[model samples]
Target: MKITSQNKLLLPVFCSAFLLSGCWLDSDDDKAVEPVELATSANVRVVHASPDAPTVDIIIGGTPISQKLDLDYQDATAWYAIAPNTYEISVEANLPGDDANVLTFSPALVGSQTYTILAIGSVGQGTLEALVVENTLTPVTAGNVRAQIVHAAPNAPEVDVYVTAPDTLLSAEQPLATLAYKGFTGQVEVPAGDYQIRITPAGSTTVVFDSGTLALAAGSDLLISATQNVVTGSSPVSLVVATGAGSATILDKDTPAEIRAVHAVADAPAVDIIANNALTLFDGAPFKGATSYIEVAAGDYLIDVAADADNSIVVIDDAAITLTAGMRYTAIANNTLALIDLDLIIDTPRKIATAAQVRIFHASQATPNVDIYVTADGEITDVSPAFSDVPYATGALAETGYVQLPAGDYVVTVTPTGTKTEAIETGVLSLAAGEIYTAFAVDGDMEGAAPQLILLDGFVVPQAN
Candidate 1:
């Protein structure tokens, strides 16, 4: 349950007792031998590679190493200096209403060595385990950089990796390495410059992953691990490049961006969404409705929304929206008919094992400013509002990203900025673990009425009080 860390100091004592003859040696024979000193310290880094594991809190020797609700899949911690000894490391899942201890390991660390401790495999399949690889920290030759590859993706098969000049043809080159799941290659040196990385099945020429162009600078030592792509994109694996200072992600160049449309404009009739005036992206979308995510090429397009009854009555005309690769976006139509506008949000739909992420969006043009509360047991008499003076939705994720919540049931209420009289209330929300809940507050169905809630992302709220 706890790790024991200790640093023992050993000082050697030498006795220079040499006499001219053997007579003086007898006086020193009673002295005891000096104790030997062992090497004192080691270095290690922890990585969360288990594709299905929850956000984790790592504890060693009763001390928490990872902050609560912070470390998750595809994340790595900085190197830590630890004394050379055996320590118990515990990984606890941040599940709601219970203690969830996922894995525990006691590793005997050696002095002066460096290690990467990885949590891998699937948690649901009961194959979760730990892998520790000793990293080589020796400096490389001049004008070259040292790199290593680690295969941490559970879903991928044996693969052939190519690291060559940009625009190099795959068929004419030999693979730099072949790796299976959890496999790795020894550290190798390459000339520092721009290069392209591609991966394919061991015996096939079909590429499954591609890093269009990457730079390897001189004097840099890197460890790149192939991991499950849980964040976004079509590729199954993303490369996590770890350096001495920190880590970075390398997404596939072929990954497409995603967009979801939301109909939040109250008093507006059902409409059809068009892209570049050519494609009808969402047809007959009613008020308070939202469309599912759709994939498209990452580029710029002029968006238009016209009446479902007649396409000539365009609600939104020629609104330019730029979509970037490897990102997910939400386009919401809000405000009144005369002042209608678009709110483009870069969505981050993250799933962690320990907690759920709730996105509270304000699209109600009726309320200029309101106080929002997410409370346990629907009680807010003595608690401060979670978000105060929240205006109607605007650009940049509406400038309010997902809020971290421990997995459990709760209530959500909204009222005018300074008063406690609720304009809308969620009776009780049975929120689940690792789920994302989006509750958009919109104008009431009728004029001069209180605001109402529109649920999205499959989260349902009970009737308001």
Candidate 2:
């Protein structure tokens, strides 16, 4: 959606703030082509704050600003340049066929001013909107950093924010401010050093959101926004730090990781899934069925799967598994009975409100290389397969990373490498917006029938008590 420099009038001419150091420019040589006009321009940055929104395409005039990098959830851009005048702009959710226009802006830009344009709220809740905050351009004192804090989480409650030293007790500490949704603080310059940010319910000392130790380097300008937690974790919010260079998210230190396990050992019986050979993660889990995600503290552990609670009849024993904080994972007991193994897959869970993200896995030992097709109503008479020759999962989740599709009814079919004969065909599935689907092609029962598709929410067995 980006246009060339020759077509400036018909397309966008936005310049990155970092390349120009928050100045107005046209090319990427760190200088302005039209220095006279650049003196009266607005320094701007765009923030994608909508937790449930897909990757976006920002249209200014008629060109998209995403030719360089996509603007995804919890992402932001460096300072960019625009003329100090009113212009038409719109934010669109980049879907498969047609993009959905989620928000539009018509802010009048004053010359010699800085601004932040944010796309906020939930796309499914019909609250997707635009927020424009004019920043005061001023110099920071030497040995100090400028901080601007904003409350951007729509459903989060009003809370007291604290930026204090790490491990400081809240009993005697005073919060910097109490901010409701969409409220922001004026730029405050403070001595640059290490600090911790925490948020508590209004007028209470019960800490609900905690950001562990953070370092504020000297002479840095920071836009620290509290946003809805979508990248994992049980906390209601996470802090996004946007500086002149880029942005990063800070999750609560105690955030847990969720894991789901699938029973895909072809010839294995209903098995007892265990962890560390002691704790029972799943008792009598049948073939082709899967366990829902179990939230556990993020760490490393060992897993074992035995028949009927008997460790001696083990199919899998003491498999090493590691989980990270604020992330989701899937572990499948795949391969044939004689060669039973596990396939670990990293799960992506950022649900976009305007589309459905579908992930397909090849876990069947009976089925060879496959050609997968997600077609209209599962039709495959004259269409090409979306994935061709997808091999079996060999100790790792052989998958197609999340594919974005328009929200609607669709059928998923899996066929042998080049043939139209379906090994697995899912009926018309009504995939709604703001959701993620994980489908695995599994081997049939011990009797040996046609392979089938097993849709699971996630994968991985938890460590037992």
Candidate 3:
């Protein structure tokens, strides 16, 4: 929020000028006027260090008041002044071959007063003074231009508003401005001009504005609001402009239809459900949770309900289901058909107390079987009290596999039993109580493994109970 002298007095003067100022004249000449006590002090000096000759940026209050000064190293120090009121002063100096110096100081100045500032070694010192001067400019056209705040996504976190304007609108040096507050509440102030606005959501690829263009005149303002499709409720975006002509536009988008899709596992291969066919739905697209129904122009879809990635007892539970405009559909997974619930569990032979369970899947059928052997008490034996045969130990295996381990450390060797003679080793595995880890062997050599490890230790284990 920048408050300039002209802005504070514009309204009254403009009204008077239009209403004929000559009509208002003081008729009482005998009244005495007491002197008003001055509230501000003056001259403050600031000096900063410049070991090697370098330039410094001087700012008073929130405005840049001076040009960069180049001072010689070992004798590098500069000074600037501001009015004696409490000031927020900032100095930025750069020394070649050394780190830059940025400092802030708040000092109160009285009328016709001076203050000296000394920042040596790295930063130099300076002085400041406030002078008693008569006012010159009258207010009629004082105003500010500000950036509009917008949300990147509906119901999502607010985004930072930005502006890219023609160089003519801004002084060549002051091309950008930063708003003070965070999210929707913050905005930047500028003199009125045509600007390009960009709203970026926090950690997102979606930008609120399709094209960044905004225009404002003196004493006017423009507010920009952005909303998303997934969001249901209402969210408003706002911005504050001190000066200029203004307008506000809310960036809005329609909400997409919410469609719940249930796979009819029992009807797989029997009923031709349009949505159950794989071709109808986009491949590799995330459709978890409720079936995300997008607004369509009106059409039929063939969905492939064939066994999904999750190998439940029933694979491709239902066939194709017809989809229509403004209509809802559900595919059910019944108890009849064996929906392949690829229920998988892996176990190690013994608790090594140092290594973790290492599950292996045959990268290729030609690869060796994934045999997990156990050596209890450091002895390789046919049978032992501490070691037991893992339930899912198979001579050969396919791609996806899961592993379950008790809380401990163990060394579980992963050897491709059918294809590769070489065994790939894993790092030490530390499992907290009931942790389920899944390993995937995509299209790769038996040696290549991109295993996903999910820690389910936070949940209770039914086996133990």
lDDT of 3: 0.31
- The candidate maximizing lDDT is 2
Candidate 1: Cα lDDT at 201: 88
Cα lDDT of candidate 1 equals 0.72
- Count the clashes in each prediction: 4, 5, 105
Model 3, residue 219: C-alpha shift (Å) = 13
Collision pairs in model 2? 17-79, 260-459, 260-460, 261-460, 330-459
- On the 0 to 100 scale, the lDDT of residue 330 in model 2 is 70
Q: Tens-digit lDDT track for model 3 on 1-465?
A: 000111111211111111112222211222211112233435433332222213455567877644334332111122233455777766655432332435677766556433333332222122212111121112213455334342322233544444556322222223132232222333445665455544445434344533223444443322333322212212232221211111112222221212333221222333222353333442222211113333332233333333334323234434333332213222222222342221112221121221133344332222233544332222223423221222221222232333334456544344444322324334455554323332322222212432211122222121110
How does each model score on lDDT?
0.72, 0.73, 0.31
Candidate 3's displacement at residue 453, Å, is: 31
lDDT at residue 38 of model 1 (Cα atoms): 27
Model 3, position 282, has a per-residue lDDT of 23
**C-alpha TM-scores of all predictions:** 0.80, 0.85, 0.20
lDDT for position 62 in model 2: 65
Compare candidates 1 and 3 on TM-score and give the better one. 1
Residues 311-381, candidate 1: write the lDDT tens digits.
Answer: 99997899887776667777778887777777777766556545677888777878778888889877788
